[model samples]
Target: MNTSKSAGEIRLIRLDRIEVLNPRERGSRVFEEIVRNIKTIGLKKPISVTPRIDASGAEKYLLICGEGRLKAYQALGEEEIPALVVDVPDEDAFIMSLAENIARRQHHPLELLSGIRQLLDRGYTIRSIAEKTGLNHCYVQQICNLLRMGEERLLIAVESGGIPINVAVTIAGAGDDDKAVQAALQEAYESGALRGRQLTLARRVIDKRQRLGRAAGRTSTTKHSHISTTTVIRTYQDEVKRQTALVRKAEFSQQKLLLVVGALRQLLCDENFVNLLRAEALTTMPKYLAERVWPNGSHA
Candidate 1:
């Protein structure tokens, strides 16, 4: 646990002699960056190591952390770099590796959740896992909720920050019945039809229904009943009409704003240059002229 820097002489050792604790768990980007940096400026930071005693009382050194840095050094063809040798227990080695990897590059929430779940499945309690991973218990619980979601797309949304963890946890708790609700929320989000507070509100509504279902010991059903082909066609027609009305309203508003801007511009021009007949409205022209001529005139 001691992190105090101690200067030691650089010694050349066979690269294969060092034992890497968690080689597979190392972040790829971090490893790549370390390689690049070592290729450019050499290994700036020496790796931390610990000495192990063999059966014959022979002492050997093992890398406690810095697998990425070690790989980068090896890639760069460096024979020796200063290392900090410390005595640490074997049980803490994997935890240290996990923390180092996480610190180097943040894992996606879902990825982190998966790692936590793996540890849990291996018989580690939430508290023990949290202590080992240096994550909060609440965070561990939130990640466990991913199992409840049962939908890969929904889990991705949560990991990408498109959905809040609490909202995701609610959706996960919905069991099988919430599939339609989750789908609806996903469609609204991807289609840009729902956003900001409205998206959150929709998630809350779905979550509330899910909670109710759990309490009742019954799965919640989609409110939208299956429609016959004729009914589907009729519904499509009704939606088309609604959308057409909306588009017209938007177009009208845009036209009005454009007209107002044009009027404002015409009024700002020299009075002699303005064509009264060509203007949209004589009333607007006079109002513009009055505003220009009388500085104190009430625009109201």
Candidate 2:
């Protein structure tokens, strides 16, 4: 594999002739956001492509990256789009796509795992993947090890920070043997791979999985669910309503507290109450609560 960078040509290419090598599922909100920004400011950067010649000697291009931008242009019915045509091979193009995907902070763990698996399938060593993707070698190995163990749930737990990456790797490769998993967990604790809440979460995951008759090898047909634009908007609206209600409740409580404190301060000024307090030697007043009732140092 060529590790050198290619300085490709920048030209306008017909959208119909470019094929998407790896298509990713983008939420409608993301697509719309891209479209809105592009419409207002035009495209900020050109999409990347690699030139290819078909069997019939016709020239076409493979899309290396920028699926969202390309799709936005297509939605606008643009026939030709500007692209940077590179002279790299198909393998490097795929790597570039994978690197871009992994670089995104919003990318799902499953999507990242898929990209890593594709690279591995293409005979790229784990070390090479680490170097190409700029991921830590240990992290790359951990993900590959988890995939090999078929530990989907554990992988999700790891991604969610429920457990340490190394601990997940250890338990994943322990097969379905409970004793082996426990032993591995103990080893992780001893080696500082598991500590604090991470150790607790790891034990809980093991117990929950075992109780549900689940293991790393369990074949779950469930795929990652993508929320639509409508769902996202609805969720945001619901959250706003909930927060508004909480704010209103807090304001009401504050008003009630002020009323109660004000009444108490008035009662404190009464001769009988003042005499009782003087007799009991409680005249100092609870400094904290008194300050709230008399913020300006005027009791009444």
Candidate 3:
């Protein structure tokens, strides 16, 4: 958002009058982080707004950017916020807003796609989008195709960094040919285009997309229940509990193994016990237990 070394004119603006140019659903992690950061350290950057004269000639600010920060301040119950007032045409303001939101930073792939579509609606070509946003032309085209096809799941995977951009492009070009898609992915993996854990994640994403045809629960038999923070938090808590129990059991098992090894070492060192073992025709201890009891190749 900081376009130059010199700062812009900062002023206190009424939060209620500023209109978000491109609004999105709230409660995402970015929104939560913005709220948390404002509460923790105050707003780090002033929002950008353009001054507009309404029908009544009253000064109203059209929010060119900073929807997240604005929403966070509203959530904090603040009536006014610090903002940078910029004098620009509405169209240019929108372009700047789009640049800051989608192109400047790493964003959710879906958001980037939507923003690109918005830019296209605003009459910007692919080359213009690339020049303004600093994205490659091919990447913009691929995103446009994905958006047009409504490939939400693939877009999600791309956004999450589970698959590479090149792989996604290849898959998008593969159309409905599952075999060609698989071949392309395999070639990418074999050629070292994808490596290590990325291949595993890419496979999972492709399989899940091919099988479910969308994100989980989208194609369910029953009616789609609304997704909310509470349900997600509850599921996370359950998983945490399960993992905690498993960890505790593992620790207990480790402790028991140590105790048994200590006891066995003591018994192996006792001459009477060795004699009793000899008399019982149990001279040779099990290889596993013997290795632990006499780790240094001792008499036992």
Candidate 4:
């Protein structure tokens, strides 16, 4: 440990006392690169630390941040490295860890997602995580999406930045049906398909397959032979005529109903015309004539 006093205002401590916060389960190539840099250039920047008081009233320095750099220094077997000690609460320790990682630019996308998942598992909400880490809510939400992907090969690609974040998000929202998701992913990989296109194709294929399966199942239970060509043609022609008649009848009925409705609306709007019709019916009009003129019980 090499400690140099600068301005005598800040006390620098050794790296041995600093602990890692929210350690990642997966190994990071980025961390290896940082270790290489440290081996070549030495410890250029000091990591941040905070004091944590124990139940016995003894204060110990806990690493509030800079986990990657600390790991690098430890791997290099350095006896000590520079650190800054401050007072911080344990509840805020994870936030400091995230900040330090972000500042050092050592955490990869997957590692960052893993850390976010850790914080969430520890009961941190997305809003609180964003506030504490100084990140936007959307960014935190995106990381949370990656966590939702869980332990899948697609998630691995997402973490490695091989897959776009949006693509990963779409895949994550596919839910826990592994076979369907895997099939979609396979198609995507084989065809170099976009995520949206992949999802659309998958849905279409599934729907088509389901329809075919239902048709097949229905046919399998019934004993039916192929009809003769003449019979088929006759059946088709009959169906066409039937459909045509139905359509024409529907059109005619619609027009008739609309005309009747319009005429009734006009009669209601014209008080004079309605009163005149009513008077005519009440006078010496035949019962049949009156019924014909006002079929709906209206005066006109």
Q: Report lDDT (CA) for all predictions.
A: 0.60, 0.81, 0.77, 0.60
List where candidate 2 sits over 4 angstroms from the true fold: 1-6, 179-300
Candidates ranked, most accurate by lDDT first = 2, 3, 1, 4
Model 1: per-residue Cα lDDT over 14-130, one tens digit each: 566577765545467777887988787876777877656656665566776677677777877776656666656665555566555543355654455455655666677778777
Query: Candidate 3: worst 10 consecutive residues by lDDT?
Result: 219-228
Question: How well does candidate 3 match the true structure in TM-score terms?
Answer: 0.63
Candidate 3 lDDT over 31-54, as tens digits, reads 888899999999899999988777
CA RMSD, predictions in order: 11.8, 10.1, 9.7, 21.9
For residue 263, give model 1's deviation from the true position in Å: 27
**How many residue pairs clash in each candidate at the backbone level?**
0, 0, 0, 0
Query: TM-score per candidate, in order?
Result: 0.50, 0.62, 0.63, 0.47
Determine the C-alpha RMSD for candidate 4 after optimal superposition of all C-alphas: 21.9
Worst 10 residues of 4 by lDDT: 214-223
Q: What value does the lDDT take at residue 74 in candidate 1?
A: 80
Q: On a 0 to 100 scale, what is the lDDT of residue 48 in model 4?
A: 72
Q: Give the per-residue lDDT digits (tens) of candidate 2, residues 108-200.
A: 766787788888888989999999888899898988888776676788778677887877877877867999999999999999888899898
Cα lDDT tens digits, model 4, 39-99, are 8887677777666555666545667656667788888887676776655567676677765
